[model samples]
Target: MNTVFVVGSLNIDQTIRVPSFPRAGETIRGSDATFSPGGKGANQAVAASRAGAAVRLVGRVGQDAHGAAILQVLAESNIDSSHVKLTDSASTGTAVIAVDDQGENQIILSPGANAALSFADVDAGLATLTPNDVLVLQLEIPRDIVRHAARAAKLCGAFVILNAAPSPLEIEGLFDDIDLLVVNEQEIQDLARLANASGDLAELTETLPSVLGPAVLCTAGAQGAVTFLGRRPVHISAPEVSVADTTAAGDTFVGYLAASLAADRELPAAMAIAGRAASIAVTRPGAVESIPWRHELPTLQDHDTQSAALFLSHP
Candidate 1:
């Protein structure tokens, strides 16, 4: 099995359930507060591990109780935390999330130690990577560090998957060497704006090849996901589930996608598997705690034999 190295953020999400999102400058009384171990990196790491991927996390936390609690959560999830560094200068990364009855969420993040991630941190954290491993990154940290990690992973002959999350302005020239680029609808819009793309999603798809050389996975929440391979596009619909929280849905998708690829599954099949896992994720609350384990994915297990037969026939 290929090892997955995740270099990103670690945050303690303080979530509150509210009647609705408050208007700007308006303070509405919240229902309840819950603290959960989250952050893109930690969520992805937990998701990957739950999906049966051997994942190693590389991130930083503060020398505080919140940081310790986050580490304990990761440990409970069976993720290796040897590379998780603790700093005395900063507090642990934190997020303030407001969730509504419809399972919608709005987040405000305080980067804390996540903002302190440097290239040296990545270099040291990923020292064990080899040619056959996978390097997963997100924009939760600095772009320069993401670039540095990508370069190192490429040099080591590892597959690079960049999840352009929290959106960015410009990411040109960075995706050329990336094996897969995962982005949500808002992120796609952000990229389209950066590349000066006009009109609708079709124009964005048309401009993908010229802008980013790697294959793109566009996640459209409840609508499902679309994968672009050159001029070919494969669409997969998400399964039905009563969503309780949509916080970790995208991270779950990315984790399962990487796990499927690591298992050498084809793109279309992998997308279906990832979509199912994500559907399951949104039905639960919290980020890492919501992701399903590999054995728990019955939809995937039932179709495994069919997929094998199809693969044999096609090849």
Candidate 2:
């Protein structure tokens, strides 16, 4: 089986359920506070492992309770953490998230140990990769490290998937070495500088492929996703479900997509499977904890472009 390698961050998310987000410098009362294992890299690694992939996660964590806790969490999800390092210099990455009644969220992040990850760290991780494996990466770590990992993975003939998050200033050069680039609406709009987009939804779909290259998959929450594979777009909509927390929906989608691809599934088929997996994820709470296993998706039909488009548009 093809191994799925995730080179990214591991964070402990502190979430609060509030009536609404607080305005600048305003303190608002929240109902509850919860701590969960999060971080885009760790979330994706956990999700992929839960979805039956041979997953490996490479990142740094603090030598503290949060980092120790994350190791146990990843082990429970069946993810290989042999390369997950623990450093005493910094705390593990932390995120403060506020969720509203409608399931919308606002988040603030501290890179922490995630920022200390260096190219040398990734290079050591890459030493374990072989051809035909899938390498999944995110922007939560250093940008130069991400670029180096992509370059090295491409040279080794591994499929490189870059999930562009927390939007960077430029993305054109970044796409040249990537086999796939996944982005949410807001990320695409900001990275591509789509002026005509009235909102996150429009901005991404309209200008994502232009600056981010042709092999782009843009995720629209509830609305499903759209993929441009050097041709006309393939749109897939998600099934509607009562959302509890959308913290790791996109990460789940990416993880499932990587799993499916590693299993030799084609693009459309993989994406259909991924979308269904993600739909189930949003209906629950927590990040990695919400991802479903591959065997649980019996109800999802395989590769229905039309139905997928509907899910992308409506749910």
Candidate 3:
């Protein structure tokens, strides 16, 4: 089995259910507040482990209750947390989230110890990686550390998957180090803007492989996802389901995708599994709580063959 090393952030999320999003300088009363283990890296690591991958998470936390809670969640999920370091000077990373009844949410993040993660920390964690392993990364950590990890993983001959979330950052030479780039509609737009590539979805998708890499998966919620492989595009429709909370939906997708790929599944097959996992995630509430286990996933009939055919035909 291929191991997955996640070098990213671990945050304690403070979530509140609100009637609607608050406007500028407007205070709105909310329902009872809840705390959950979150952060893109932690959520994705849990998702990957539950999806049947050997996963290890490398990040930083504070010497506080919130940090302990984050480690507890990882331990319960059976993910390796030995690389998660505790700092005395900083508090654990925190995210204040407000979710409306409709499941839309707004978040404010305080990086805290997550920002304190150094390249040395990442290097020590990555030392366990073999060429067959996969390195999963997100933008929640410092850009320099992300760049270093990506470079080191590439040098080690491990496949690197980068989830460019939140937004695009000006990280030099980062794109060249990525094996697979995953992004949502908004993220793709942000990437296109950063790369100065213009056009509609099709045009942009067709142009991305030449600029970003050989593979770029651009997801459009409800509308489905488009896979760009070396100028070829394959469209995969998302499974229709009622959404309860969208928290960690994207993380679930990325996690399942990495798990499937690490298990030697082809890109198309991996993407189908990921899409299904994400479809199931949004039907539940909370972050890690919303992700589905491998046993819980329904078999997709002919999905692999059909998706592969689409991919090949496009090429």
Write one digit per residue (lDDT tens) for candidate 1, span 237-305.
666789899998999988888777777778888788888888898999887788888777765544322
Candidate 2 or 1, higher lDDT? 2
TM-score against truth, every candidate: 0.92, 0.91, 0.94
User: Which regions of candidate 3 fall more than 4 Å away from where they truly are?
Assistant: 303-315
Candidate 3 clashes: the total is: 0
Please report the candidate that would top lDDT against the real structure.
3
Question: lDDT rank, highest first?
Answer: 3, 2, 1
C-alpha lDDT values of all predictions: 0.81, 0.82, 0.86
Give candidates' CA RMSD values in order.
4.7, 2.7, 2.8
Per-residue alpha-carbon lDDT of candidate 3 for residues 132-151, written as tens digits (9 for 90 to 100): 99999999998888889999
In candidate 2, residue 17 scores what lDDT?
Answer: 88
What's the distance in Å from true for residue 231, model 2?
Answer: 2.2
Error of 1 at 115 (Å): 1.7
